[model samples]
Target: MARSIKNPKKAKRKNKESKKKGEASSSSSSVPSMPAKVWQPGVDKLEEDEELQCDPSAYNSLHAFHIGWPCLSFDIVRDQLGLIRTEFPHTVYCVAGTQAENASWNYIGMYKLSKISGKRRELVPNKSNGNESEADSDGSSSDEDEDAQDDAQPPVLQLRKVSHQGCVNRIRSMPQSPHICASWADTGHVQVWDFSSHLNALAEMDAEVNTGATNSFSMDPIIKFGGHKDEGFAIDWSPLVPGRLLSGDCKNSIHLWEPLSSGTWKVDATPFLGHKLSVEDLQWSPTEADVFASCSADGTIAIWDTRLQRTPAASIEAHKADVNVISWNRLASCMIASGSDDGTFSIHDLRLLKGDSRVAHFEYHKQPITSVEWSPHETSTLAVSSADNQLTIWDLSLERDEEEEAEFRARLKEQANAPEDLPPQLLFVHQGQKDLKELHWHAQIPGMLLSTAADGFNVLMPSNIENTLPSENP
Candidate 1:
């Protein structure tokens, strides 16, 4: 035992000397310059052994993903979501992050999941077949890396990281063209990327390296629009418009962008200058492809006609304070919801806005509602996120009882001690996050929704609700 201990000390000294020699030799050789960005972005954080608090029972979805981006401020992004397309038979999310204090080095990370638990056998792919079912136009996962597959340990199975430039404010995967996505940044630029190109190039590079051919990962943007004069914070790709994209900047200017026939994106010369203050958010109308709405810090929501840049079709004072978020009902052509800084949300019906546009007022939130979205699968279902760590999924299908409402109002008029009845519209109330920053309804998945905040992210589509499809009655 004594000899073993002494030998370890001697071995440590000799190892230190050999490591010094190795460093010297490496310095002398024609070493490749360190790449501008580290290739592995989220590997360290993803491999960090932490107990995942999200219970699988709360989510029936198979492909839900969690992206942990360590950003300094909460200025990551807001009001944008397109369901992530997985490179494998799983749900995937890519988050662009930087080191906690080092804002210059940004990382875009992807986490792929696999399951090994006995209970989750049905949820995960059956690997006994020995064939994977995922290959993308961008070549994200290819046959070249077949040997790289490892035994699953549950939860997360794979992770990849790529670096990016500028402070990315928002990223929205396009629905019509899944390969193309839009990214807006603080540098007043709207950039588009074809992930297929980036991922295909990466796969090809890996194949070359495996065959003893050396190369590097070079990611380039497919298109960039820099017409905004100030911070380009908001971007919304039209669900109805095939390739039309709408963007808003902090300088109260809105620019419409489209792909030209010449294979280039062009910004409209006549920018919409309707709002007097900074544009807070933008949402394309659900029913009309050519019509959309923009909420502003000036406490107004302006409806615009895309064909004419002359003036707004309608400008309604939707809030007493700055309107932070706006969402159109997927099923209702005239219903729109707006959340404001005054800790209230209003459901406005354009058909009934002749005098007062506010239809139903909700003050359940103690903080400003930062994000609001209407469910695509269920009619009259609205989800809103208050920074006060609450995500309320409300069902607006409740019918009011005339007698109950009249009696409650009479009790209020008499100042009698009567408890106000809980609105029947209240559905699921999710809480416990530090700050519920953003919420979105998945464009494709029925009843599915996603929310992210300081605590983490939540993906849920309540199964035990009256989720009758709108198509059933339509």
Candidate 2:
């Protein structure tokens, strides 16, 4: 949850009163009071009705409908938002709002597969030999006849929602429900909207609001957090863990919350602290519920095991500037990747220990690396976005074989000596008009990459079929 600090004047007033509470309390209790009266019939009934109307179910029904995909047209983009799958080859991408002297609403969009047409194909089931002859005699098709009628269809892409209040900086999907936690700059609040049941489901008309009025169920978030003295920059949900959330603020603090039986949420503990600068991102460990990672402007990344509160399980001072993002390798629990403002990206292996020491370092970048992500379906591949206006995919599997490294280096040298015969680096760059703010690979699809840039453009780069990138091979 996001919140602001109390005003200093108000805090001082309370502090002053507390210091003289004994002297002030006795005299303050003698204030006059009004006598109570019996309630009026009509007036009391109306007030009771108003109170009942404030209930969540009475106020509105949560409905999700498909909004057309957003058009990418913005200038001076500041961030990117995306959803992807590690097992499938698809991605949904959104560009952050832009402010190029004038303010216009920014939008989110999904990538389109060029070669695949947006068409629905009918499915027909096959018949086996036992029922084939009998079914055919009664005008019912045999399994073979049914099988011949089935056709493979490309997946249909749908636009989910459009933000009217501008671009969304951060978004997270809930594990237990089809809900999303979205943080917006316009309101400086995080909204939780139910969207799970809407996926692949048909849309329906929104229920009435005022009875005399027709109301469309707006994506007015069910719960709003923040809008206090501080604004939120990052938000995340515990994967597969219900009702657990974490959000980071500019004051360099992390807030944790859990749901209560009353249907409202409350703080679970004191804010987690360690970073001296604002935290840029937070990620829960893929394998462990109690473990997580946080990167900060203080040029460090710390791994936290919630079970041990005294200190981080591991801290790496691998960057010279703020660590913008950190991603855990879902396929390999012991591996993690981080991108930083110092124009470098680093991958660390927790399993490799050298006589009680750990190996943690970085590979340099030409510009500030704003985002980093490990392939959810592939163990050895990682992706990073940078201010250099390019996104690069890394093959960490290359590090495992000395012969492959030597061969790559030899190819590089040969390329330098002969301009035309050199082998290409596995790293591919997706060019943008401005600095890339963020990059994400699909959670289910291994190769599809989604990127947002400073110029207010979101692009989806599908995995090339010619690129025989290994899933676990890197």
Candidate 3:
């Protein structure tokens, strides 16, 4: 949302009253009260009297659900709606693998969430006749609100689960065929499975059907490969080449999977060995069919081309600590984003990789970054989740505007106070989740994001940022 001040005079008055009271208390007590400031996770330790506060107005819509066990990885399945959808009241399909306490209790869950709707609240209160008006009572409505009514029914979730052999380390959906997905097992095996049956079952369960009752399905992986020497987390499907796949392991081996006419995959026996450490993540180029990228524990990013020999076409020292994840921008093909174990993430322009390619860098997250993804709709936007229990959205195009900052502080100093060191590019910070592991932008819904944490999952769209999604109108 465009920067604006909320309320200045009222906040100043309240602050003055509190300061007076604090001064009176200091005369008798030795302990001094901590001044009010925007709480920064990880950087600021919580006191016994402190508790996290959530602002309901910051989100247009939010929902949280659990499927019994924690899932370390998940993928959003593409729907019939073509990519670049900006419509509201959306429906989504997703598949996730569980990290259960008992390996036998682990399952692969397929989900269908429908009637996902909520009204977008205005970030700035409407001013009329020198009085502030609430967003909900302003009596102004738009088409977006028509689709997302204020009293819209809560989103419905229908789930279908299938038993898996071991804990799934990572999972990815095929870009061309969302129902056909692959998973990396902690048991040192990569398996491909067709979940079309589970999809069909979920699709048949409409609103009238009872979704609270869990349904279990029996199935086996369509194909399994146990060539990797150890368990790994890196896996991705090529967007340019349908059914083409890549998998890397803890033992520093990467395999190329080529689709065959027989419906199975032909993985290269001779692996691509470039990294000196475990491959942590992999991403196929959005524009190139033969080219892909990988990040490793060795703190390097390797660009590999299957057409060439098993060596990396180019390798860059991306981070000081282990490079944990990477995302190739689909709209901006030349730009790539990466997150690292040192709690920092950076954006690099591939065209200048040989020179000074890092265009932007952020050290906001105070813990190891868990996931990073560029928005499918906004070229300059991206989302990141960290072990610090925070998911932050950023817009790289923004820079510090001293004039705007001054106006905001002058008018809304007490309403929405922020640390002076807060980055201007930081759009929103979402918390409340414990041990966030992975997140994905819904391919079919503009601005919608689904994240999986140790507790469960959260589906949300921030009110301040999501309204900026590209529209046909100006």
Candidate 4:
């Protein structure tokens, strides 16, 4: 899908409706079309139109977050209650490139995420905050959250912008780390920052020094991991091992970084050269600390064992075009999914230590596959995103009949173009936005999905998926 200048892409989704071509698309005659929303620009503010925009009963989705500049990447932020709110959570971090009128440097903004009638909203600073009335309590100022009056215009919350030296390509929120996130840029570097301490002091610092405008939180990098001569793009923080970082660059140089007690990251002396071309994506094995996988523009995905750094334990030329992304099944460590520019995704079973490796392959995409993520909650369920702006939820639970499998092998033996196919396991396919950049399963919620796209961000949930889970209401 072509990315829009008005908005960029990042999203996650799954649906209970079966999308097997025979199943009908959900009828939306009663559903109202989503309307475009505008941000007030700076911090802690949302436009107050009397009519509420949220209508999940009809739309099955909610519009959320409006960073003024178009964003390329984003990661979720946890609220103070530790709940995952797809709609205006406590905070969200996004990386966006410079606009025509802006400077050359790219920008990163930390915005307050919130919700109204289940609709997600980003509260940017209001340009008209000067005349806005904020309720005062006693001699002390009222809490910012409490002072957001309902009758008049809403008060601005907070918006902080930081400029980067290069175009920001990716951002990954560290697993289990409330404050730490890694941001990679075209400058061939990955920066890790812990902003938890900075946030609490921000308001106090604002009071201490009367800055006319909101200053971007000036948090320094806790650890700077660099060494790639080429622009670095692929990065993954090991969820199995704390503080172990992996980043691969355009030239296929992969470096390992480990955080040391001295408050710095130690970069390995030699780079792991596992691919002949740029590494497109890296994913840490969900079950193993010593194993990780890298997909590359060289049209292969290499499984690297950190213990044996000499070379990858296994490799496969899995596609006709560059392999753009990879994901490991969280429930089944032996299963791995890799997507390619050839518009196909192949699932491999690494447990098969010897013969014909691929277990299944899907080739329905007509454009480059941008991202793939295995659902944290379900076994054999995976999400695939395409440059064609499609999100397909695939359940790889289909088992093959022995006779049918043999027939396909016989055909492959007889004809050069013979095909091997897996049984239909498509659960749902959704279309929205101009470009689909990322698909992520909400770590805490089983049917909830967060998606980023060229037009805007969407928080979606499958209406039917609710029946399969233990409902909060029930």
Pick by lDDT: which candidate is best?
3
Q: Between candidates 3 and 4, name the one with more favorable TM-score.
A: 3
Score candidate 2 by TM-score against the native.
0.58
Worst 10 residues of 2 by lDDT: 4-13
Residue 50 local lDDT, model 4: 20
C-alpha displacement of 72 in model 4, angstroms? Answer: 1.9
Candidate 1: where is the Cα deviation over 4 Å?
1-66, 70-100, 110-154, 157-160, 197-218, 400-421, 466-474
**In what order do the candidates fall by lDDT, top score first?**
3, 4, 1, 2
TM-score of 1: 0.66
lDDT tens per residue, model 1, 291-404: 989988899999999877557988998888989888877677788899998878999988865678888989877788888888766767788888666677786766656564
State every prediction's TM-score relative to the real structure. Answer: 0.66, 0.58, 0.86, 0.68
Give per-residue lDDT, candidate 2, residue 422: 15
32 Cα displacement, candidate 1 (Å): 66
lDDT of 1 at 406: 61
Give lDDT tens digits, candidate 3, residues 1-474: 344322110111112333443232111234543444456665666665554444444556778888778999999998885665545567788999999888888889988888777664443444655454343243345334534544587788888899887899999999899899999999999999999988887877875443753555678888999999999999999998889999999999999999999999999999999999999999999888899999999998999888999999999889999999999999888888999999999998899977877888899888999999998878888999999888988888777788887766654343445567767888788888899999998866677889999999999887666544443211
lDDT for model 1, please: 0.56
For model 3, the superposed segments whose C-alpha errors exceed 4 Å read 1-37, 81-87, 120-152, 213-215, 467-474
Scanning candidate 3 in windows of ten residues, the lowest lDDT window is 5-14
Candidate 2, residues 246-294, lDDT tens digits: the string is 7777677777666667654665446678888887788887678887888
